[model samples]
Target: MPALPDPLPDPVAPVVPLGQDPGRAAADRLLGQELRRCREARGLTLRQVAPVIRGSVSKISRLERGESPPRPRDVRALAAFYEVDAQQMRVIERLLEHAQDAEWYEQFSDVTPGFLKRLIQLEGDAEEICVYENLVVPGILQTRAYARHMVRAVMPSAEPEEVDRVVELRAERQLRLMDGPLPRVVALLEESILHRRCGDAQVMHEQLKHLLHAGDTDKVSIRILKMSREWGVTPPYPITHLKFSNGEQSELAYVEHINGANYVTKPRALDDYRNALSNLRNAAASKDESIDLILKAQHRFGDRTAS
Candidate 1:
């Protein structure tokens, strides 16, 4: 079996769930996986295919692992090496081109492989982000220290270098909202998110201060769904929505537990999460009150709240 990625690490920063339509990415993933299978079926290993492609075993390994794109030359070489027909190679090459043009995220192949990088690009390019958090702050609101702690928590086995890379990637992801015409951001969080301290008190304080600023921004909103409210119906799950400038929208969600993570992207699967966020808006504290809640959380850090 492919090695399982490290368990759900605490996010260094909050990432609004980006529901990427994985049609092409899925197809590309299948292409790469299929290519690997074809080569294996031919009783050839990377060592065997290396000379034909004028590459090393590691390059072949990367292609098979879906850690990198299969170059056209590499694809043609491998296809010829595997005796695959021209028609199949054409399709694979097209997918490979799309993969190379990835626009969203690039640093998380360890956590997300192959076409997933492309999906992240589409999500990052979204015009609006609607997120519902069951626990903790969103990535955009997390301070660097808190974000690093979160990534490290679930990746205890990751090499120090890998952990730092993930932390750096998380920080980069958080920079999206600051650029371009700022996207609309609507975030709903369970009250407990305010209490969880993934980092030192100072880190939490900085995070809270950032959240307070976000709440005041016209482009951003952070709302709290406190436990004290008498919510008539419990939300079935967490959900996130990404809307494009053209009005295209997609919802993505996932749940994490002791077993691992179960991602949800289907429309029917995502409805409850969206609804839950909607319900929290009416049930939780007001937007203004939520801002105050975040202020209180940040104030817990020290005498100087914002600096």
Candidate 2:
């Protein structure tokens, strides 16, 4: 009935690492998604909502995309404009508080890349992680030595200190993976990865042994995809599928390449990845057979080290 006050300018927020406050980041995304859904259901556009919230179209867009921290006043204005029920309003209020909470990864923001920060955050929140790797071992399952070698290979120009920081970050992620009972992980490694040497014989041996031990855990499953002529189709790039606890925005598909990565949220694209994962699972060796394969690879590396 009355015009809302103009939205206040957002402060220049610090560059906090994405993983620093995964819970908050997740809340921001979920809240934005809910706002966007409500707007679409009302057949309203960002331009229409902007004036009611006393903000620009871009500002409204940013709010709906969760790119910026939400203002309580703006959120209240939006809720009133949308005429949401009391129950829905309560949910929004809770999300707003969670989104504004302090994060843990703030200290590492200076060293971590934005994409990596986001990935780590997603991994942290994911209820289940499905990895399809054709290159080196997935970061979550890598041993410290293996991680160091891979980091050096990927970031050759990085300073020694920076490289150590990256390795430490990877180790921290692995520790987080083991710390709680939240994320159940399934890793599919191409058979060739076993032969692809990341470092010297000792490194590869330790890495393979680590995978063997990890596979024994109830929370982790590791399978090997053997090279075969009968295998019809395979995904061209590495894919990490993350399923979260939230019902509204439950799943995310991460496709990574040499230069950057793409986060796939579209239902159709996610379905495609799901199908590819199914095919890969069918083509891959069973867990026991995969373990044997890993053991053999470890022995080969062990023999080389002993020589």
Alpha-carbon TM-score of each model against the true structure: 0.59, 0.67
Per-residue lDDT for 1-307 in model 2, tens only? 1221112211222223443665676788888998888888899999999998778999999988888888889998998899989998888886775575334444567677666667776676679999999877999999989988988888889899888887888787788776656689999999889989988988898899889899999999999998763757566668888888875678877776555566777666667777778788888899989999998888888765433
Clashes (backbone N, CA, C under 3 Å), per candidate, total 8, 1
Candidate maximizing TM-score: 2
How do the residues 1-307 of candidate 1 rate in per-residue lDDT, one tens digit apiece?
A: 1222223323221132344544446545766787787798899878989898788898878777666655767777788878877787766665664555353454466665433343356455567777777766776667778878887887878888887777776676667555444467888888777888887887777777778876787888788887787746544444456666643344444444444444545565456555655666667688878877777776666656345
The lDDT of each candidate is: 0.65, 0.78
Model 2, runs deviating above 4 Å: 1-22, 25-102, 303-307
304 Cα displacement, candidate 1 (Å): 2.9
Cα lDDT, model 1, residue 301: 64
